[model samples]
Target chain A: MSDTKRPLSPHLQVYSWSLEMALSIFHRATGVALGGGALLITWWIIAIATGPDAYDQFRTVMSSITGKVFLFAFTFSLMLHMCNGIRHLFWDMGKGFDLGDSRRSSKMVLFFSVFLTALSWVIGYGMILEV
Target chain B: MSLRSPLGKVRGLGSAKNGTHHWWMQKVSAVALVPLTIWFVSSIVQMTRADYEVVINWMNSPIVAVLMLLFVTTGIYHLKLGLQVIIEDYIHSEGSKVFLQMLVTFSCVAVGTTAGFSILKIAL
Candidate 1:
C-alpha cells in the first residue's frame, strides 16, 4: 500500500543550519526552560516562608549534584535569554537591522552569555565555599 | 471641494496604536529588570546557607518586599506580552493562538498575584 500523506518542507534534518538559526532556536528553548526555573524559584520562596522543614526539603534537593547541574543550565539559560532579549529590544527600536549588525550582535550575545554564566558560577561557588 | 465626505478626513488613523504602549511598557520593565535581577541573584546567593528565619527576615524588610513584588509582577507582565506576540506571529491556528494568549495572561496574573500575596503575608 502506498502512503497518501505529503512530506513536510524544510524539516530540520534536511537543511544545514547557520549560527543565527541555532541561536534563535536556542533562545526560545532556553526561554521556556528558564520559565520553568522561575516556577522553581517561586517554590523556594514559598518554602522559605512556610517553615524550616519545608525549607530544608527545598535546600536538600537544590543542593544536590543533579540540582547543581540543573542550576548551572538555568544560569546559562538566564544569561542567554538576557543577552538575546536586549538584542530583541534593539530590534524593536528599529536598530540593529543591518546584516552586519545582526551577525555582530548575535556573536556578542553568544560570547557574553557564556562569560556571564561562567562569572555567575564562579561567584556562586565562592559564596557557597565561604559560607 | 464637497465631492469627498468628511468621514474620509478622519479615516485611516496613524499608527495601529496598540503596540506602541505595550512596546514602551516592555522596555520600561526590561530596564527595571536589570537591577532587579542582579539584586535577586545576589539575594538568592546570600541565602544559600540561610535558615528559615533569616530568609523571612530578609524578605520581611519593606524595601526588599516591595522590590521583590515589583520584580515578579513586572517580569511576568513583560514575559506575557512578549510571548503573546511570538505566538501571534508563529502560531497559525486562530483558536490556539487565542487560547495560548489567554493562558499566558492568566498565568502571569496568577503567578504575580500569588507571589506578591505570599511575600506580603511573610512581610506584613
Candidate 2:
C-alpha cells in the first residue's frame, strides 16, 4: 500500500458521543454479534443430530459458567439488535427521523432491550427451576 | 440557463435506482421477524427440558418447520444487506469492501442453506 494523502470523510471519532451516536454504533456491533450467534444455532442443530454423546457434551459446555456468560451477552446483543432493528424499520417508513423522535427512540431501544433481555432470562430461569 | 443536453438531466450520482429496494426489504424482513423470532424464542424456551425426540418432533411440525425456514432465510438476507451497508460506509478500500461484501453474502447463503436443509431433513 502506498502512503498517499487523500480526503477522508468524518467518522465517529470526530463527533462527541451521544446516546443516538452510541446506539447507532451499537446497532452495527450487535448485528455482527447476532450473526455469530446465528452460527451457534447451526452448531446446536449439528450437535443434536450427531447423537447423545455429542449432544450431552454440547449441553455440558453450554451450561458452564463461561458459556452462561456468553449466552447472556448473546441474549443482550440479540435484544439490542431487535429493538434497534425495529427503530430502523420505522425510519424506513419515513417516520421517527426528527430530532425529538430520534432521541426518544434511541432511549426506547436501550430501555426495551434491557427489559426484554431480563424478562427472557427470568422466564427461562423460571422454566429451568420448574423442571 | 444554457441549452442543456438530455444526458445532463439524467446524470446525477445517487443510488441509481437501487436505494429504496434494500431499505424496503430490510424493513419487510424486520416486520416479518417480529412474530417469527417471538415464536422461535418461546419454542426454544419451552424445549429446554425436551429430549432429542421431543425436539425433533417439534421441529418436524409443518408450521414450526415453515416458520423456522422463513426466519432463517429472511434473517440472513437482512443481515447481508445490513452488513453490506456497514462495510461500504466504514471500509475505505473499495477492493476490500467488495471482497467483504462477497464474503458476507457467501457465508449467509451457506449458513442459511445448511440450516434450511437440516430443518427439511428433520421435518421429512
Candidate 3:
C-alpha cells in the first residue's frame, strides 16, 4: 500500500527543537530503556526463586558500583516515563491540548520526574546504609 | 467494475476491526501502572536493606504476591505494546518490522511467564 512514491512527511531535521518535542522523544527513549529494566527485574525475581545462594549472588552484583549506577538510571527513566505517561493520558482525554498548557505540562513532567527519582533514591540509600 | 459495497470493501481491513484495541490497551495498562508502579517502587525501596529471607517472606504474603503478579504481567504487556509501536514507527523495512515485532512479543510472554511463575512458587 505504501509502494507509491508519495511525498513523505517532514523529517526530524526539518523542525526546530522544542520542549514538547524533547519530551515526546524522551518518552519513547525512556520507554525502550525500561524494557531493558524489565529484564533486570525478571532476573531478580528468578534469582529469588532459585534460592538463597542465587539471591546472594544477584545481590552482590546489584550492590556493586556499576549496578548502583544502572539502578539509578533505571529509577530516573521510570519516573520520567511515568510522569510523561500521565501527560499522554490527559491528552487521551482531549484535555491539555493547548500549546501553552502542553509546554507548561512538559516542564512539570520533567520536574516531577527528577524530584521523584531523587526522593526514591534518598529513601533507598538511607535504608541501605542504615542496615 | 467493483460490485462490493463500500463498507464491505473496507470491512476486516485496517482499523476497521479491533483497530483501536492496541491503542486502547496501551492506555489501559498505563493507567493501571500508575498506581502499581508507585506501590512496587516504594515496596522495593523498603526492602533495599532486606536480606534474602526477609524478601522471600515478603513475597510470600498473599497481598504482596498478588500485586507482584499484576505488576509483572501488566508491565510486560505494556512493554510489548510500546516497543511494537516504536518498531512500527522507525523500522520501515517490512521484513525487519515483522521480525522485531515477533521477537518483542515472544520475549514479553517469556519474561512475563517466568516472573509470574517465580512469584507463585515463592508465594505458594
- DockQ: which candidate is best? 3
Q: List the residue pairs that clash in candidate 1.
A: none
Over 4 Å off, model 1:
A1-16, A127-131, B1-19
Model 2 CAPRI rating: acceptable
For candidate 1, write residues B4-105 as lDDT tens digits: 455554353324535356668878888787678778877776666677888888988999999988878777776776787789779999899889989988
- Model 1 chain A worst lDDT run, 10 consecutive residues: A122-131
Candidates ranked by lDDT? 3, 2, 1
| Candidate of highest lDDT | 3
Worst 10 residues of 3 chain A by lDDT: A122-131
Docking class of 1: acceptable
lDDT for model 3: 0.92
Q: Report the Cα lDDT for residue A46, model 2.
A: 65
Quality of model 2 by C-alpha lDDT: 0.81
Residues A1-131 of candidate 3 have per-residue lDDT tens digits of 47879888788899999999999999999999999899999999999999999999988998999999999999999999999999999999999999999989999999999999988987888834553
TM-score of chain A of each: 0.82, 0.85, 0.87
DockQ of 2: 0.44
